[model samples]
Target chain A: MERILEQIPRFFSGPNMTLLLEAAGLTLAMTLTGCLIGFGLAFVLVYLRQTPGMWALPLRWICITYVEVFRRIPFIVVIYLVLFFIQAVTPDASLFTIAVIAICLYAVAYTADIIRGGIESVPITQVEAAQSMNLSRLQTNIRIILPQAWPVIVPPAIAFAVSFIKDTALVSQVGVFELTFRGKELNNQGYSGLLVFGTIALCYFLLSFPLSMLGQYLEKRLATPRGERRSRKIRHS
Target chain B: MQHLEVSDVRAKYGTLEVLKGISFSIKKGEIASLVGPSGSGKSTVLRALMGLTPITGGTVMIGNERMNYSSAKEVRAARDRMAIVFQQYNLFQNMTVMQNLTLAPLKIKKWGKTDVITEAHRLLGLVGLSDRANAFPDQLSGGQQQRVALARALALKPQILLLDEVTSALDPELVNEVLDAVRKLANEGMTMIIVSHEMAFVREVADKVIFMDEGHIIEVGKPADIFDNSQTNRARDFFSKILRH
Candidate 1:
């Protein structure tokens, strides 16, 4: 306990802070790329859902298979799969590039699932209303439907981003110089272990706390009153 | 020429059949009201005509062209000639009332902004929502949303309008204002097919009143015959139960 306490001053005074920033940057890059990839796939899959039982059955199975396999295999395994199998084909790929690619592939699977739920969450009548206006299927998707689904989709997306920031620390094992990697190296170089990890944690909190708060703020702001949006906001309390 | 004709139509959703062998004809400039209890296939008839629900067997001929389900392009061409208003008012909540009203004409017609905005304001004025033109759907009452819904349907300049109980979802107090707005549109000789339970509006405004049961339209007649003096037992009972109060 004394050792842990003594490390605090050493942590703030050392070079560990810069490493955490690098980790946070890699995480954001992974999450955004993953989100964009997943969102694009989800857009395509939603149209496949409009087909009849036989045509949709196989397509749905493929999507569910992709999501379930990647989600359950563990992120560590996903990185290794990209490293060993993909590296065999594309030798000399940098660790940073590989980490970003693996995290994006993993994140895309989950984000696609999230977007699928968001698309389904929109009421059927809303889509029909777009059709009633003579908008085509694609037009209806971009113009009428996506606009309504966006507010509902935002809160969860931000929540995912915050957690994803922490998850990027795992990429350090693949030899990327992220925040966690830097903290560990600093501690190994004779900095106090407790102080190093503690400072690392503070940096993480600094990175994620505002994002977490922003998610909550957005959840409150985007929430529409079912009975009386015009008269009063729906009270969360 | 008859403006619209429905001959022996069968429409289905999933495995359940709705609008089973329903047939009707509407003259130009007529307001036809379909009245039925819930789940009685009244809404399905309008959906069938709009080609939202696929027809298993039948023909919907408007003017000389058949509602051809033979190809996607054919169905799309038929859809271009009509507009729809719903009970939920299904406004684009993200857009202001003016944006909602103008989107159809601007997007579907490729009309210039100045032309569409001026026409959109004219339609909003017709529905008495000129003042709330900039408000979102969330900023308006149920009545106001339905009024904007009317203005939106009008902006497309469609020859036929399908209204699926446009007032049923509103608060009771708000229902009258929307009905009055619809009544004015009906008076202007718009070819309209209304699915509604507002018997008073039907009796006074509808050229024809149709009573549907299960999946078929059981009876249809002049407003006096269908409402005050219904000829069929299904029609008579529906009128008695819905209008009892």
Candidate 2:
């Protein structure tokens, strides 16, 4: 306890603080870049997985297998596997790029199920009504299905991303220089382990706290019916 | 000339056949009501016409054009000429009544925005829902929603309107409001195929009443002939039991 207290000043000095700040920025960058790309690709995966008729059966199987396989594996394993695979294919790939790719791969698997559930939560009757009106499948999804599905999808999706701020620590195993990696380096350089890790923990909380709040706010806002929200807006105006 | 003709239409849910070679035809501006026990394929017939169900072995001819469900473009072409209202009042939950009525016209049909909105307002007035234009579907009663659904279908300017037990999900009191909307459409000479249990309304408005049983058309005649003088025991027994109440 005394050692932790004594080293606190050094731990939070100008140079150490700058290092921590850069690591934090790297962590946030990796998570946001990976998750945003992953979320977009998850939609494509789910759309292909739901392709109608016998012709797309193999495509459907491949999507399903990818989601199931990646979801069941550990995050660290995914990063290592991605590191080796990318190195074999393109030997000069940066560790940071490899980390982002691994995070993206893992995120697509988990969030694909989230997206599929959100889509399926919409009543099939809605699709039928759109179909009868000569609305194409793409039109139905964009106009009718996805708008209704957003209320179900956004909260959990945001929650997943917020939690992923911590999950990104796994990427440091491949030497990506994120928060955990910086903490370890500082500790090895004669800083107290307790002081080093405690600050790192605080940094992660600072990053994720606002995101969690945003998720909660969205959950409450979206759960209200559109008419009620409109009425509220009118009343406020 | 026949406005819509479905001949020898067959449909199946897996190996269990639900519609077995059913045939029916409606002239321009004619109103036909299909009545039968549940699962007798009355609803399936309307679904098959819209290509909602796979018609395994039949052709549908709309005016001079034969509908080919095998080709997606042709199926879409067939769909473009018709609109259907479901029993559950499946309005887009996220949209307001006006948006529901105007979406297909403005988007799919690519009609002018002002013109589609004008037609939407007119149709809403026809269904007595002009005041509920900004209301979401869940805010309205089932009857109002179904009426909005009818107006939404009309906004498409479809040549044929299909009503699949449109009032079945409504309360007893709500049933009349939805039926009144259909009656208004009928008065305007809208061509329609209504699968309904409302025998009294069927008898009053239908130009032809087709009785179905076990996926087959047991009889087809004027409303009075089918209701008061059914040709098949299945039709008579079914009608007597439901109509007695």
Candidate 3:
């Protein structure tokens, strides 16, 4: 244990440091881009699934099938499947592009389900109230329903984001040179495996800690009954 | 032209018919109460009129305009001139009392900012919730929340206000505050259709009372007629049972 602790400083020193920093930057880039794309697609999917009428039925079928297909399978299997499918279609596609696409496809399914749950958690009476007030469907959703739903949505969404950030490490298998890939390369060059793995783990913790804390703060803030939330924020912030 | 007329309205939930051809009309500046035992379709009538329930057969005339239930857009256009306060006091839980009252007026009506704010404040004062404007629905008591719901409905300046058992969910002590607000609105000549179980309060405030049973209107008359001098056995039976407790 002490030896592991001692190697931490050495992990940040030497030629290894630059490799670590570069990998960290790539991981951040992939996570940010993938999350944005995935979240947008998931919103479309949930919206299609929630809409009424025959026109939306086929769209909803496609969305439901896509979500179930991706969600039921292993992420690594999904990554390999997408990689092969993309390469078969366009052999010249960049490795980075393939990696981002794979992560986003996997992330979209889970995020869609989480958001749908949030939407359903809002009471039916809310929509009825909006209807009676003569607010359009778009106005009702944006103003009444979404605001009520976010309290249920934000915690799960952040959890998925942190998980997806870690999942970006899986892209290393496809030659993306993200964090895990860098750690493995350093290990191959005769560096202690313990130090390399430990450093990678530390980087992940550093990246995810603040985000997790922010989610907790949000959940707590929302849990406070509405009127008091503003005053409490003022008191603390 | 009548203020509102529901003619031969028929509604159903799957195979079970809830309103099997009920007809009623109210004049402008009239406060009508629908009093009946549970499952008598009093609430269904309110829901049908508000476009919440599908009226499979019937015509609803608001002033002289026929309510267009042909499409959702048309239904919304028809509903734009009316509002309903639900039994559950469905105030948007995320909004403060002030926002609940002002949201539709500001968003749907496109009212000016100063006008909307002033109107919300006025209605809040009218409901005796002037100081609780910043309180969220959950933060306030049941009575306060229902009052906020009433003020929110009034903010739209709806031509017809539908109240669906507004006092049913409140504590006995809390019931009076909500009923009092409704009474004040009645005095001011708001055209309202209230489905209430509060027999005495209904008698006191309603200009006309309609007694319903088994999805049919058994009697429609002045409050004293139904409550005191009923002409139908069904109305007399309902009044005796409900007013006994």
Candidate 4:
């Protein structure tokens, strides 16, 4: 136990500390890029899924297939699949780039599913009222539907973002040096596994604690009556 | 010419027919009230007229413009000349009452901000809700919300107004205020079709009262002829059951 306690100080001050810091930066970069690109692609897929008329039928099917395949398969399997394909197509692609691409592809499916739920959560009467006013379909969607769905959409979206940040650990499997990968390396280097892993867990907590707290804060803020009025007042003003 | 006309309008929810061969017409400045028990398709008639429910069969002409229910553009065109106020008031909860009134006019008609606000204030005053203009729907009583909804519908300057039991969802004490607003609108010669359980109000205000049963209009006549001297046994039976309460 004393050796483990002593290792904590060395763990923070040694070469492994530099490796951990670099990996932490990479982890953050992966998470942010993955969430942004993934959400953008997911929004497009959701739009295609809901687009009217026969011309969108094939596109909708493709979107459905994509969401189903990504959401149903394990994330690690998706990481492997993305890694295998990228390596086959371009053997010299950077490992970090491959990891970001893999995380993004995995996140897209869940984001779309959550957004669809948010849209459905809006009441049918809101649409009916918009239509009654002769607001065109597109007008109603943008002005009425989206505004009402936004409060409901945001918290879930932030929740997904926090999870995606944690899910960046999956990238370490493809050998992108991130927090977990660095911790594994340090453990192999003679430090106690408990101290090494405990430090890594602390790093992850440092990153994710704020995000989870943000999600909870937003949930309360958006759910309040005053929040509803304040948001609408801002929009109108 | 009739302000609104429907003939042989057929609508269904899935395989269950809600409106079967329903036909009615309201003159340019008349109030027609549809009254019946629940599930009699009174509300469905209003929904079908506004294109909220798909018209499975038949024709609707709004001010001589034949509506093609299957075409979204044509349906929207017809709706522009008409607006329906729902029983639930269905106010946009995320908007202030003033914004609710102005959103449609500003968005659909491309009206300027100043004109929309002026018109919104006028409508709010008309509904006796000028003080509540800045308030959200959730902040108002049910009656006030329904009145604001009525004013919001009128802000569009529609030639025909459809009211689907607008006062039915309000507290009993609050119903009279909404009815009074409707009565004032009627006095102003707004062409309207109302579906209500306020039988006394219907008898007093409706130029023509149409009694519906199941999926058909059982009787259509002048209020006195229908209420004081209903010809159909079903109509008399309905009146007796309700008037008893």
Candidate 5:
């Protein structure tokens, strides 16, 4: 305890603080870039998976197998596999790119289920109503189905992304200079392990807490239908 | 002239056949009511016409054109000329009553915005829901929602309107309000096929009543002949039991 207290000042020195701050930024960048991209790709994957007819049966099976395989694999194993595979394919690829790719691959698997559940939660009758109106399938999804599905989709998707901020610590295993990696480096440089890791933990909390608050805000905002929300605003005024 | 002709239309849900070679025809501006026991394929007939259920065999002719369900373009062309109202009053839950009425007209049909909005207000007035234009579907009673659904269907200006037990999900007291709206549409010469259990309304407004049993049309005639004087034993027994209440 005394050693931790003594090293705290040195651990938070200007150069050390800059390094930690950069690492925290990298961690945030990795999660946001990976998750945002993954979230988009998950929608495409789910849309393709729901393609109607016998010809699309193989496509559906492929999507299902991808989600099942990645979700069952350990996150560290995914990181190492991505790292080795990317290195073999392009030996000059940056570790940052590899880390982002791994995070994106994992996020797509988890969030595809989230997206599919959100879409399926909408009543089938709504789709029939749209279809009977001569709306194309793509038009039905964009104009009718997705608008109604956002409330169901957004909360869990945001929760997944926020939780992913912590899970990104796995990327440090592949030598990416994120928060956990910076903490290890600081600890190795004679700073107390408790002090370095403790600060690192605070940085992660700082990153995720505001994100969770944003998530709650979006959930509440989306949960109410637009007309009701407008009337609610009128009543409040 | 025959405005719509469905000849030996067949459909199946998996291996079980729901519609087995059903045939019907209606003239322009006529109202045809499909009356039957539950699970008798009355709704399935309307659904098959709307392409909501794939037609396993047979053909539908709208005017002189044969509606080929196997072709996406022709199916869409058939859908463009018709609209269907569901029993559950499946309004788009995220949108307001006015938005629900105008979405297809303004988006799918690409009508002018002001014209679509005007037609929407007119149809809302027709359904007596003009005052609730801004209300979301969940805020309204089932009757009001069904009326809005009727108005939404009308907003499309469909030549043929299909009502699949539109009031089945409503309370008894609320049934007449929806029926009254349909009555008004009938008076306006809008061609319609209504799948209904409301015998009195069917007798009053329907130009023809077709009785169905176990996926087959047991009888088709004027409302008086079918209700008061059914031919088939199945139709007679079904009507006596239902009409006695």
Candidate 6:
């Protein structure tokens, strides 16, 4: 424990600190942009679920394919693929922007699925009630369906954001100079592994602590009415 | 000839037909009670008229304008002029009573803020729930929630109000309060198509009573006549079963 405490001072006084902050910035930028893109796309995807006939199957397939591809493939492969195919084709683009965009594209797909499931879980009667009031499909989606779904989907969405924040560590592989990259640079420059890596972990905690707390907060908030913790624990086994 | 006429309307869900060739005419300032056993398609007739359910055949004419199944917009216009109080009390649980009442009116009519609040208050008072306007549905009793739903429905000033077993979900003691509210609405000459099983309420407030069975209108007459002298065995059996239960 004393040794761990001693490591904090050595970690903070390390040379590659600015790069740690840079990495944190890149991670947040990527996650937020990706999540926002994912949120809008998810809303559209879920709303499109209500539209009838020939359009229905195709829209569902698009959403499904998005989730399927992103969920099945490793994020690192996606980054490399983007670097190879998309970046190769586009050129003159910064790697930071490309990495952020890639994360956003991938995150958007997963969030869309989470949001879609949340929307679908809402009672059909609620949708029908809104419609019976002469609320157009758009009004129903915006007012009734999405608001109800938001509370249910938020926990997972936050979890994904935190995980994605950590995933940005993976972005260092793409030469983005995120915190992990700086920590690696510092350690390679002869800073002890304990000090450099400890700083990196602390920076990550600084980024992820609030988000983790928020997820915990949400779990508590959602659980108060349900009192399902015991049941959840029982089911896990 | 009428404010609304449902002519031999048949509604189907999948291959199972719910309302088979039910006909009724609702004049302005009329209150008709529709009563039948559970799953007898009493609610389907109302739903079909609202276009919440698609009609397999026949027509619904609202004040000389034909409601077509070809486009949702056409049916939507007809639905806008009618408000339905459902059995489950489909009030927005998250919204306050005032918000629920004001939402459709403000959204559909685009009423001013003062008008929305004033009108919502007036409607809440009409249902005897003026004091509970700020409460959420979760905060209200089953009876109070139904009252709020009634107020919300009436807030739209619909030409015809559809009460699809609105009191069916209430506790026995709570049932009377909602029934009293409906009775007052009936006295005020609101054109109402009430689908219910509470025989006594139907007898007291309904100007005409319709007895449906297996999607067909087995009997249609005054509440007294249908209750006392059901012409068909199906109607008689239904009346007996529900009343006995």
lDDT of 5 by residue, B1-245 (tens): 89999999999999999998999999999999999999999999999999999999988999999997998898899999999999999999878899899999988899999999988899989999889998889889999999999999999999999999998899999999999999999999999999998888899999999998888888999999999888889999998998997
Instruction: Give the root-mean-square deviation of each candidate in angstroms.
Output: 3.8, 1.7, 2.9, 2.9, 2.0, 5.3
- Per residue, candidate 1 scores C-alpha lDDT tens digits across B32-65 of 9988889999898888777788889988898998
Candidate 5 lDDT over residue span A15-127, tens digit each: 99999899999999999899999999999999999999999999999999999999999989999999999999999999999999999999999999999999999999999
Q: What is the alpha-carbon lDDT for the whole of candidate 3?
A: 0.86
**Residue-wise C-alpha lDDT for candidate 6, range B148-188, written one tens digit per residue:** 98988888889999999898788999998998899888888
Tell me the tens digit of each residue's lDDT in model 4 across A1-237.
Answer: 999888777777867778888888888888888888998888777877988789889989999899999878988888888889999999999888888888788878888888788778889998899988888767777787777777787898888888777778877778888998887878888989988888888888888899889999999888887546565766898
Which whole-number lDDT from 0 to 100 does residue A226 have in model 5? 65
Top candidate, metric TM-score = 2
Task: Compute the interface RMSD for each candidate structure.
Answer: 2.7, 1.4, 1.5, 1.7, 1.9, 2.9
Between candidates 3 and 5, which one is better according to DockQ?
Answer: 3
Q: How does candidate 5 fare on TM-score?
A: 0.95
| Separate DockQ for every predicted complex | 0.46, 0.77, 0.71, 0.67, 0.69, 0.44
After superposition, candidate 2 runs with Cα above 4 Å error: A88-92
Residue B205 CA displacement from its true place in model 5, Å: 0.6
> Model 6 in CAPRI terms: which quality?
acceptable
- For model 3, residues A1-237, the per-residue Cα lDDT tens digits are 686677667766876778778888889888878777998788778887878888888888998999999888987887798889999999999888888888788778989998899999999999999888888777787888889888888788877887778878778887888899998987886667877788789988888788788878877876776557766765798
Instruction: Please write out the lDDT profile of model 1 over residues A163-220, one tens digit for every residue.
Output: 7778877877877777788878888887777677777788788888998998999888
Q: What's the true lDDT of residue A104 in model 5?
A: 94
Candidate 4 displacement at residue A204 in angstroms: 1.0
lDDT of 6 by residue, A8-54 (tens): 66666544456576667877787788777767776676566557677
Task: Give candidate 2's error at residue A115 in angstroms.
Answer: 0.3
lDDT of 1: 0.80
Backbone clash pairs for candidate 5 read: none
Give the per-prediction TM-score of chain B. Answer: 0.96, 0.98, 0.97, 0.98, 0.98, 0.95
Which should have the higher lDDT, number 2 or number 6? Answer: 2
Candidate 3 stretches greater than 4 Å from native: A1-12, A81-94, A192-195, A198-221, A234-237
Estimate TM-scores for all models. 0.88, 0.96, 0.91, 0.91, 0.95, 0.90
